[model samples]
Target: MTDGDEQVSGPAGGSGAQPADPPVTGLAAPNGGASPRRRGPLWTALALVLALLACGVPGVLLLGLVGDAAGRSAVGRKDDPATAAARRLGVRMTAQLDRQASALLGGDRTGFLAVAESAARPDLTRRYAALRALRVTVWRPVADGAPAAVDGRPGEWRLAVTVDYCFVAPDCTPSTVEIGTRWRLVGEEPRLVAVEESQAKPAGTRPWEVSDLAVAVGERTLVATTPALRAKLPRLLAQAEAAAKVADRYAVSGTPPDRYLVFYAGQAEWQRWYGGGRPKWTAGYAVGVGGGHHDVVLNAQSVSPSGMGELLRHELAHAASLPAEGYSDRSNWWLVEGLAEYAGADGQPVNRHEGLAEVRKLVRGGWDGRFDSLAPADDATDDRVGGAYGVGYLAVRHLVDRYGEQRVLDFFRAVVHEHRSLDDAADQVFGDPWPALHDECVDYLRAIAG
Candidate 1:
């Protein structure tokens, strides 16, 4: 990941590595579609993940609009009939929820008994309503067993009485929708477990049409272009698997079936997609994500012998881990880069990209430093790309080996739970300051690099 100004406009140049590399502009986007579709949902489901990603970041959902959820007036409304319907369902669900919630909170035995008894009767919520007219389904009493008696203890409780609202907006288009719900009793009153409601158009997988070597991952779905590139998919999967085995700190689902989502971007859209007209970096990336979906996209031109899977791996790693750059985390730069690079390989050293060696050599001091652990990554404010991976990777490697795999996981978890300062963690765990520890790492790398 080169800096913004490091654009290679002319001929591609590089160290004589096996697979050449692209002049990368730190940021890129997956090439999926806003294509028209039929059936289930393509963009809609994608929107959920995207929305979640956008959460706590700037400008998601609202796009440019404004409103507040969990407030009286909701902002960022996508008020299409489907969304409105979902909102309506949310409202009714909240009402039924409120009743049980009241019973639970007030500890009103009489009120609770009335609601609980009604809850037990067959189809009680909409007992009198017609299935066709109400369009409601009640699958109450879900515990992987029979219904339970509702009491404060040792009793079965059901809270899910689902309702689907379908009223066409002034547009007069008959909008169809559905929502399913199931609730379980925590003590006596039922609590919501599943509430799914959305509008969707089953869409096609979006891959950059021009590229023959992009990667994407989902449920049993790994799509790329050519057989040569496809061959690399297993390696990505393998790397994910091995890394997951080493520690449970990097992915969501244990890497068993990567919740990873891979997308391919065609050559045409590459210029416009990410990095703006030139190239740029993006926020909201997972530098050390444990799981969920990740996208690996590539351009057609990237398959040339000059191209390294670095960008694919970088972005994918960011998808898996995180890709915070600039002011976000001046301290953790080295760490995020090294972990991604380590995870980027196809498992076999023979298949590893040679450019990586260039990086490794640089860290080792080209026969200079004593080879302890590279150098401390300069604060992110410096904008120097070299130190981030050099220092951080060595530190991570040392920590992983020194503490045992489990402790390394514990360290990462500590970061998540006690995410304050590296120096603090060092002080707390190793009884040292971060800067002092980093110097030791540099000396260590220098020693090893020799």
Candidate 2:
């Protein structure tokens, strides 16, 4: 299935994790982190994260960056002209970004234009003017990169530096974006010349370009859609709030995210924003982005009225549970997906009984792939992918039945937050090895489906 922002891959043959929603590269660059370790007590890290959030660090300390180019005060050793120049250029670029961020956040088109190149300022101004809410932080400023000679200019050089930013809005999360800009020698000091966004625009399409979006902000959701779908906002908001509440219940031990950002558009708009990799059947997806927010994108054209809540909840489950850094181990794809389904399974796309029946049919048809071996539904048939969802849901359901809800939640924390191997985490909760846990899950599915 095609990837959505949160990728609402269908029940089968689609992204099971949304598989994080189909790998559609968007405005934000992917957050980087080490994979969950196979060994070590991961709960130690979980404890620290929880402790930080408990200290009300969610609003202020949302991100911890490694470098700040804009704020660099270091002066290299004497006689180092290149370092001095880089530092000088870095300061100018930082100021430009600060102005850009301030203008975007304040909805001050004129202010934003002051820092932008005249050519792009009009478009930027229009986009910012239409934007409802925006927050920008330059986590890593443009710095330290060396300058290269421009293609045609003899004396002039260009330094291309990537600025890492966290952009949050009413209908967007604190999604990480890497904006590249070239600083060129205009007169004396290096000045901003060209800027490049990571995501390429699909021809003739952008959310801001969609002229008549009706936007509304709920207590825990931000809904934006065309006038045709505007009436559906109230119900969507209610369901999102309910889903957030449910997700919070499971995530009380960790950081409960802030208000979710839901962008409702048709398939075309969805594809454009998602940078085009979504499967045809994908309804929508909610991306668990960094900086304590999630990005929910839904294709209103594809989702049936009854299925919207379930799909949103399914994505919300991912938003609530998955770490901001993203899930690393593909081997636990089933659990990753199953936990989402189990959490959001108020029953619409498919209820427990229906899903079980479907799994039973698949087992009868000789399906043999273990949950651990199931990868994202990149190439598999839809039926094969859907079976993964069913089996995953049942697996999580069995765990919940056996260990209770909190333990199941803790298991996720150990695996995702703590970065422990699935086996190691299962060992902590079940007190036995992972093989035994797998067998029990299989047995549970059989008993329920037999």
Best by TM-score: 2
Per-residue lDDT of model 2, residues 1-450, tens digit only: 323223344642223553342222223332222222322233343334345545656442212121243223343534233333333444454556555656666666677667655665555555555453323333333433434434455433344444343434334333443345555444443455555444521111335433346666666666677667779878877877777776666552376666666778765577666464666546666554445445677777776776666677777777677665565566666777788777767533334433565577666777663777754455665566666677888888888878988888888888866779878988887787888888888887767667
The per-model lDDT (C-alpha) reads 0.34, 0.57
TM, every model: 0.39, 0.72
Please report the candidate that would top lDDT against the real structure: 2
Q: Alpha carbon lDDT of residue 242, candidate 1?
A: 39
- For model 1, where is the 10-residue window of minimal lDDT? 10-19
Give lDDT tens digits, candidate 1, residues 1-450: 222211111001111000011111211111111212322342354345344444645432211111112123345645543333233323333444445434433444344334333444333222222121222122111111112222343322222222211111111111122223444434323344433222121111122212233343333334343434555556554443333433234542234223333333344544432232321221112211111223333444543433334434444444434321111332344454445444443232422333334345565434343322322221221222333343444555666556654455444434433455775666676655767766776666555444
Looking at model 1, residue 66 earns an lDDT score of 11
